[model samples]
Target: MAPLENLASGRGAFAPSSGEPASPSDGSGQSVGSGSSGRKRVPLGNSSAGGGSTSGNPAGDVGLGGSSGQPGNPDDPFILPQENASTLDKKLKVEVPMEIVVSCGPNGVVLHPGGYRISPGALKGKGAILAKELRSIVRLRQQVDPMIRPRPSIEFLVEPGGFDTYHEARRQTVISGLDWPVSLQVADTKVLDFFPGGRF
Candidate 1:
């Protein structure tokens, strides 16, 4: 168990439901702060020798292990504990893999420039046409060109905070594109960040 997990028992570090957590001292020689970043962390040896209390690791999610998503709060999609994204999204019925790369204007889905031959700044065009296409792309996330093997990202400007209802999220999708099916807008994002449980 790493130092970041929040023990439901409130004793201390919790073993991630997933697997191992990340350790800050791996290279930096800087120890991970314990007890919610305020209290002192007992040395790993001492804690284990005494059969340890729970509040041992304080690195949070990272200490839990590899990032498996797990966003800061409910509004975000970081819930899972594994990073096998494509497969994970399918299990969650999320439709696609997307995240907020930038929380400001022009922050659209990033077509990861790998294996695929598509060009950036080119997928971009002038005015509403571009926005419309992007909006359309979002709508058709369930269906993608199988030939375009590269994984794609889908980003939606969440309601300043979060979607109040399923209907609201759907309605916002429509309204965001009111000007051109993909109008750019500002979204207030909550990025609290819990450590990934590793298997998400």
Candidate 2:
């Protein structure tokens, strides 16, 4: 998705970024993660039922489509969606670190390291998004973008502000004013390791 420049008016929402081709689903309701694709799809279902497992191996044999149970990274940091089988839209809550940059982007506030977007209007007052570690709930819509994979849309539970930080595009340069418009480009790309090595 695109990034934002103006925080108050919500202006400068850049064009949605080009998406990567996602692996085709075989109607099994089992979303699998590929080895090279930097993307992982955790199938949505009720964990209590005979549906798939939420953690460990998502493609377990008891799920909608019975398979050999493909293995997934045990150390994966993401908390896959579960407990809701009614819709393709799901929410994944994550705690964002101050080290990762933030800006007004898709959803509302976009976090770096992963281009995770927050729900619109979730953030309260904001000078710069990277003031501290934030608890955010990310909305993930699987069916929205057919051409590309789904990215996390976040909604912060706490407000971020009252801290001085550098501009979005100009690294090491402090923002003249707290209310100045911040762009996604102002994010420090050098420190963040995004998909494909950089460029989120």
Candidate 3:
């Protein structure tokens, strides 16, 4: 008879035998290494059930692929569209009144009511000189005038035939002197002609 230790060693105690098959079912009907027949295995944490993709395309996942509208053009749209020269003139033109006053004395010119003054030597042309005088008058009024209303639009009260020498070009140059959006009119103390004949 073998010693107890020899007998245990010969029978391979504490080691599993390779000849016996692993149990396919241990109370749970599924196999230890694979699923049962006719059953499909699914991976954990799939996103398909929520109607989205794992690729992370927000628009594509919602079935909106290529449906997003194009971006707006950065160029200004308010600019007037191009047209024939005649049409362009009609669309883009502005009118401002021309009023003239004459002071030939050594004391120079004084814009009455507003009291803004300019020198006789400063009179280069009827339009240019008068525009400068008007601008100065506007500045002084903005500073000292007590009226709380909007600054009054300028109107030229020319003496009779005072601006007869001013051609269209000279008139335009004078009109450019005032800030934009100003209303202007010209009159001879009785008859008035609003500039630009038509609405802007």
Assess every candidate by TM-score.
0.17, 0.16, 0.32
Error of 3 at 170 (Å): 8.2
Runs of candidate 2 with Cα error greater than 4 angstroms are 1-103, 125-130, 134-200
Q: 1-200, model 1: which lDDT tens digit per residue? A: 42344333233433358544433442333336563544575556235333333445334244224133344654445555556877655555533343222122232333211112212243333343333444445445435543222233433333344322212333433445543222223343332121134210
Candidate 2 lDDT, 1-200, residue by residue in tens? 33442422333333246544343433453323564533655545535345445553445465333454455444545636446653442323322222335554333555564676544443433543333322232222323333333333322222233112212322211332323233334233432332255433
lDDT of 1 at 80: 51
Choose the strongest candidate by lDDT. Answer: 3
Backbone clashes in each candidate structure, one number apiece? 25, 7, 0
lDDT of each: 0.36, 0.36, 0.43
Off by over 4 Å in 1: 1-97, 100-127, 145-200
Write model 3 residue lDDT over 68-111, tens digit each, in one string.
34433335474445579976654454433333333223344445
lDDT of 3 at 110: 46
Clashing pairs in 3: none
Worst 10 residues of 2 by lDDT: 162-171
Q: Ranking under TM-score, best-scoring first?
A: 3, 1, 2
